[model samples]
Target: MNSHTAFVAAMIAAGMFVLLLGTFYFGNFRRQKPALWRYVADIDRAGAMIRRKEYDEAEALLAPLASKSDAPLHIYQLRAAIAQHKGDWVVAARHWKAARRYFPDDALGFAGGARVLLRAGRRAEAVRMLEGARSRVHNPSQLTKVLAEAAQSAGDWAEGARLWEQVRNEAAGDIDSYVRGHDCLLAAGRPDEAAAVLADGAMRFPRDPQIVRAVAAAAPPGAPGPA
Candidate 1:
């Protein structure tokens, strides 16, 4: 071939190579960016992986998307939970704390953070954090049980009873919670209060065996029946 024709063909070949390379590496000429959709799909799979207790795989899938500005709030939640599954309470608490800012009205962050601390044997800090979280929480009913346990951890039987009372009120048929409340009151050396709770239970659920049994069990030897 002539030198001029050969030079022209070489230029065309180089241009074609650049076009294919851009399309392959950068997803050129596609709708939005392919990576964005892939990120979303990765997150969904990661959540399922987390549920399956594949923490390492879930974390690997989430790591790249976690740094995205528009990353889902559950990314941090899952990270914290993954850490929790691995028994790394410190890392779990840190991620849960970060997630808390995104979920100002939800108790997941506060509850998870406090629970990890409690499990890690930091009762004082856990209770303190849980106390602060109480006001910020929007759905008290949803967290009644969580708060009750935290109160028990803090050795605040009165608070535990109060939260269990909240639970009982929210779920009127929740005899289990009322029983727990009585137990907490008894633990605080208030047998009278314990009997009172059972008595109230019997009044509310006249036919429930739970209330009948609890009332019988809560009484002290030779003590008058609950008022």
Candidate 2:
């Protein structure tokens, strides 16, 4: 063909070559989304194993995903649960901590760690772990009492009082809050506050034998009820 026709053909060929080269380079050089579907499915299988109480097998399945950058956060959680099942508190504690480390903003991680600490009898640490996590904790009403008890156990009576009051408000007529709050105040050498809690309990629950007994039991000789 003529010079112009030949030049046009060369240009078309060059364009096609460039297009194919980029496609091949990207296909090989650039990492594609790793196929995480199988990892997710395996994680689910591990969960089933945990439910069946086959901790060893569950752990084996979870080992691969535990440190995988793209793995779901539940992998470490399941690992922690398995460790807890096996009664390895140390391992469980670290795994729970790792879960939180991987997801700083995740409530599940903090809750998991706090739960493990509670089970390990590290009451003070558990309460401290829960301090920042209380708002994010699941089932706040139930957890409020747990954290309050932990605070009381740790002798942080002010924190204990606050947590118990939170539970009392959320639970709406749970006598345990008033009773336990009174006990915590006594532990902290605050008899006046203790009496006030008991008096409140008696006011709210006039017929509750437990509150009446507590207030009477706490009253000084001949001082009358909750004066």
Candidate 3:
């Protein structure tokens, strides 16, 4: 080939390579830059503040970021956590609600809301929130126990008994269920049933003082205590 023709071909090849490289670089930059730069800066700053135990300032910074319509769910979650740490229950609830709006099926948001309600002494509301969280929670036993305790506080013995039974069943080998079940039975005025439950528990856990005492307490006036 002639030198001129070879040079022209080489220039064309270099130009195509440059164009391809520019296209890929700019495309990657355009796709990643705004998300990485815009989203991460505030998130990282907020995280740093949280790590430094400056929850209020972290939350203040996160709030505007989280308020954006397109803000990430995690951002809202962080804001909620910050609000909770700062004892701002109302704001925490609002942030959690916003997080839930973005991810309706999020277990953490529901659980967090329930915890806030419980802390705020809104037992009935907490129970309702936990009921909604039941399907979403991987392990609802803790929340169920809290709900049962709330019921007990409200003097709803029947609901408390049912919930305690559920917790006892979930706990399986744990003695807490037996204790709670015994107390619940006694509280519900079913002493005979309580005696039976305690007797059975004493047989299974012979060394448990609570079980022994429960059996004794539930027995009829002339009934013998556990041997």
Candidate 4:
């Protein structure tokens, strides 16, 4: 064929392919859009019900959604929340574990499970659970912070100090990290490390009264005062 005729045919074929793609995309989107909205709306309603202390209704509302083959991760979270509020630690743990099992790459399940365990005063278990899932969760600093707190609560001061330092390394701007890390270090009988943490926090947050006080307290009896 001549170049002109060949070019025209190619252009028409490209146009048809583009039209086909657009038609399929928009048609699929239109079909799924309403279901997406309803799914979100139901999740919101269930969340509100849980917030209002309507555990039974929240559970009922979430049950059908959870039964669906492609149920969202939120369903398990909501169910766990309801179980937690009702003081059913066993059920809460189960749902949170299910969330982790179903959504391995998400941090919410592991973090939420650790939170529930912390609330139930199972500090060591909470730490262990989060530690095991450390490699799976994305952006695991938040879980690291939780583990730090859990270690502190369990009186595992050495572990707490290590985890808190990890948190501080991940997020230098987190004031709690410096304060908690320093405290845990002190509790673990590491005076030098504690002093170092306090000094760093004092330098970064010079005006923060907590860190300022910590620095003053850590100073030697004959040392020069803050100027």
Positional deviation of residue 81's Cα in model 3 after best superposition, in angstroms: 13
Name the lDDT of candidate 3: 0.74
- TM-score, cand. 3: 0.47
Where's the lowest-lDDT run of ten residues in candidate 1?
26-35
Ranking by TM-score: 4, 1, 2, 3
Give per-residue CA lDDT, model 1, range 30-79, as digits (tens). 22222445466777898899889899999988877666655556678889
Stretches of model 1 off by over 4 angstroms after superposition: 1-44, 142-144, 153-158, 170-179, 182-227
Give the Cα-based TM-score of candidate 4 against the true structure.
Answer: 0.61
Cα lDDT for residue 158, model 1? 88
In the predicted model 3, the residue pairs found to clash are none
Candidate 2 ranges with C-alpha deviation above 4 Å: 1-39, 133-227
For each candidate, what is the lDDT? 0.76, 0.78, 0.74, 0.83
lDDT of 4 by residue, 1-227 (tens): 99999999999999999999987876653321224455898899998998899999999999888766457787888899899899898898899888887677777788888888788778778878888888887767878888888888879999999999999888788888888898999999998899888888988999987777777877789988787
User: For this target, which candidate reaches the highest TM-score against the unseen true structure?
Assistant: 4
Every model's TM-score: 0.55, 0.49, 0.47, 0.61
Q: Per model, state how many residue pairs clash.
A: 0, 0, 0, 0
Q: Worst lDDT window (10 residues) for model 2?
A: 26-35
Best-matching candidate per lDDT: 4
- After superposition on all CA atoms, how large is the RMSD of candidate 2? 11.5
| Ranked candidates (lDDT, high to low) | 4, 2, 1, 3
Residue-level lDDT of model 2, residues 1-227, one tens digit each, is: 99999999999999999999987775565423345675878878988998999999999988876655556667778899899889897898888787666555556677777777887788778767777666664545655677877777778888898888898888768888999888887887888888888888888998887887777787779877643
